[model samples]
Target: MDCVKLPDVGSRSLTTALIQFGFVQSYPDYSLFTYCKHNVRLHMLIYVDDLIIGGNDTAAIVKFKSISIGASIYLGPLKYFLGIEVAHGPEGIFLSQRKYALDIISKCGFLGAKPTSVPIEQNHHLALAKGTLMENPNRYRRLVGRLIYLTITRPELCYCIHILAQFMQSPRQEHWDAALRVVRYMKGYPGQGLLFCSDSDLRLYAYCDSDWASFPLTRRSLIGYFVLLGQTPVSWKTKKQHTMSRSSTKAEYRSMVTTSCELKWMKKLLLSFGVAHDEPARLYCDNQVALHIVVNLVFHERTKHIEVNCHFVRDELQRGNIVTCHVRTTEQLADILTKALGKEKFAYFLGKLGIRNLHTPI
Candidate 1:
């Protein structure tokens, strides 16, 4: 056998510092680190700075450490990492980071602020000229930035975040107030977050909707979607359409096209994981014209304004890769993100999105 040289202690510390932080355990007799990959067992043995990791089972490493190190080692119950708080309960695994929200609120000097019931006022049309200009735009920008990050687990705030994000270049006093409204809303829903269950059926279902010419300044429509795996939401988005839509029907069709592309990608990904869908994926849209456009092949004169790319939904329908169905406006999951809603309607849609008050035990 040939002799191999290992790196010194200094080199090991440098390598660890360069990598993302994780637990490090040292055992004299244990030859390697072990972990599971794709539900298969694997192991790695380390000798000083050198390591060798693999195998079917790692009982030898555990037994060796038990005899030589006189201690039993187990991996982790690591609940929180990278601002994502994790909790495992009988219902499922709940994930959120309320502490991070508090930090942002305090940093923005809104800790003692009064709570607001709604994030954005109903029937209030925010324009580019509303409210006095803010002297320090950076503070408002930072606050909105933090809130955008919070949307990862708080889909309820997606609309508010999108509106505030637009004013980042020149946030005014009114924009700051709107930002605070969201923060106050967070204060009330501190414990609220997302839950993923072991019992959930991994079905790909999506709902897409758009608000026609919702942005007064740009005359651009807002397109939004909510993708669900069974009853739990897995992905969502609220974005201003790049081109101005001529009518609500055109806007809704554009949104459907976007959702169809997402479903197609998801179908391919699911196939790679060996999961097959019994039926074509379903997409819910509130607009009847858009649904008709998707199912019908002929293009009418009214649809000339729609871009060619937006016609992909028709192809997807032809391929039997997706089925578009009509959902009532009240039941549209994307409605919350596309436009401002009343308190009752907002709460109703929130419930529809699988969000619940965690403070009152499920």
Candidate 2:
């Protein structure tokens, strides 16, 4: 009875401890913080109990450990945090989960399988009835679940994992094979990860696109979008529409709606994180009709079925939260999230997404 086990006690304790140590919560609400007590500045990232402390000042970190309701837990040099391997140098930090990727490859038994440049084969369509049912649907479900987590660093798997996740409740043999192919693709660059360069531009830019009627039986389109803070991707999603779109323009416009909302939130986040990006953020889409709809505001038969909520995109465009522009399909970053691609096209997009292998010599 001496110790009380109450809801949020852990969070409260951590918050109280951090403030006592002069660390101010910054990003993700309370997950990341900055400390500047006694002219020593440092940044600390807290993932529950695990912590990653970083800064040029080593003494500030030692002072953080001095306030002891808790013991100092030094995991050392910040190589791995929350399953992401970090390689820090003069250039910047490179983040990867090579160990996690290898574990997924082993669990799915794709160790010796042939590797491919792309996660999904070109024009590969996975329908519900296309393959026979697997005896254990959980097996397929688990593999897809790992792929979903893997997408944190491996965005190329977004479309592939999104497709595989759909059949989790009743996975088929085709789904199993498709999921395995993604694992084999992971084998090609098991150490692939993102690089956040020290000298890269911080201006926010985004690429969004939609694949028209990619789902066969449902006839619903896939929406894909990725927001880049400089050359690094910060936010991305690949999801199937809940309702069917009447035309390619409608699908693409819907994708814009989602991306605009994400951009709005990201803007607010940047300001909260102590970096204000006042320059007009650039949002690129492959569909000209979609960009035109936001700028021109011409209502017509094609735009009739679009819900009222979707018009927030137009509102944001007017306010200049972001500027919508058209890019070619080949250069669209969201393409990786919308559909499968050929080896050459896939490799092109993969590199463009800032995914590089840590094992390779820089």
Candidate 3:
């Protein structure tokens, strides 16, 4: 076979086909193939064109590779398989995508732009009416989409990205300006990426908060939740509520309900991984009224309008599966995810959430 003439394409598809073929082959001489067994389970991750194969079974892998070459195209030895740059060493595998970051920066025309210390300015409220509308809304959408992808490894900018994404359909000039600020922020922290430490405590903790009637146009509160695996933030979200809440307490109660659902799923996932939660996970909320509502067994006049579905928090609390506690507003790390704040407060909250400017030297 003229291997050089084969186009550099469909590597992942070809690999999958080869694996399937190996499984289907009915030859009785299959025992002749070399096989190695190891205690460690191998992990093979396929992300479109990128293939990551790692395990302790060296001999089995060699045999698989030998069969793979006969049935499909074979790529050379893997160094940097995906956007995640891989560096092998005695210490361990060091993964980063500095080149990817540089390419994004250059393509966005932010390579020479001045770097900003913050992703979103303190006291920044980006309403659509304040500035001129964008002449090309599609361009704005494309930029926002790319930035959203970048946030996969940059949780520090998650809130800002959420805020900017709201204006994707009919972006205004102010929206574009806000998006540019994010690019500037990224420029300053190009190498700032998530570190999946090889060894760390995996205890799960969650914080939830709501800003009642935050949007000027919709009068809807913003609900935000941050879930942490030990000290590192693994998942988070900042989004506007679907329905308007009559009071701050009701808004917060609704936020609690949302967080409870997530906690339930997370607990199940952890169990699948062989991690058991003997006790209910703690949920920290800054609103005292919400906490009271969740714990209060008595149904009151003020709580009548709250839907039955929203009382899931109360049921969970009663079951001892979720414990709700009042957290001080100033120390509430989820506050940044709920609304815009002054520069000093934003930076303080960002730091509290375990988001550090990685550009700073250790």
Best by TM-score: 2
Clashing pairs in 2: none
What lDDT score is found at residue 355 in candidate 1? Answer: 82
- Tens digit per residue, CA lDDT, model 1, 1-362: 01122345454553353232221222322333334445544344445544343344456434323332212233234365456677778888787777887787677666777767678887765565567889989988878888888988888889878988988888878888888888888776766788887788888899999999999988999999988888878788899999998898998999998888878876764443446776888999999988988887786887776778888998988888888889998789899988888989998888777786566411
Order of all candidates by TM-score, from best down to worst?
A: 2, 1, 3
lDDT of 3 by residue, 1-362 (tens): 01111234575555556456442211322211111234533334444434444446666555555653333445554545445554444533344455666776787788889987778876677863567778989888988887777665566666788888888888898888888888787777676654444564677778999989988888999888887766666677777889999999899899899989888877765553346787778899999988998888797999999999999998888888888888999888888787666768876876666554344421
- Of the two candidates 2 and 3, the one with more favorable TM-score, higher being better, is 2
Our model 3 lands, by Cα RMSD against the true structure, at 7.1
CA lDDT of every candidate: 0.73, 0.80, 0.69
lDDT tens string, model 2, 1-362?
01111223377788787787677887545677777655556776666667666665666666555555455445557677667787887878888889999899888767776787777767676774567889988888777878889888878778888888888788878788888888888888899988998999889998889988988898999999999998999889999988899899989989999898898888876664557877778999988888888887777876777899988988998887888888987798898888888888878887897878868521
Clashing pairs in 3: none
On lDDT, the candidate that comes out on top is 2
What TM-score would candidate 1 get against the native? 0.78
Candidate 1 residue runs with Cα over 4 Å from true position: 1-75, 360-362
The TM-scores, one per candidate, come to 0.78, 0.90, 0.77
RMSD per model, one decimal? 8.9, 4.4, 7.1
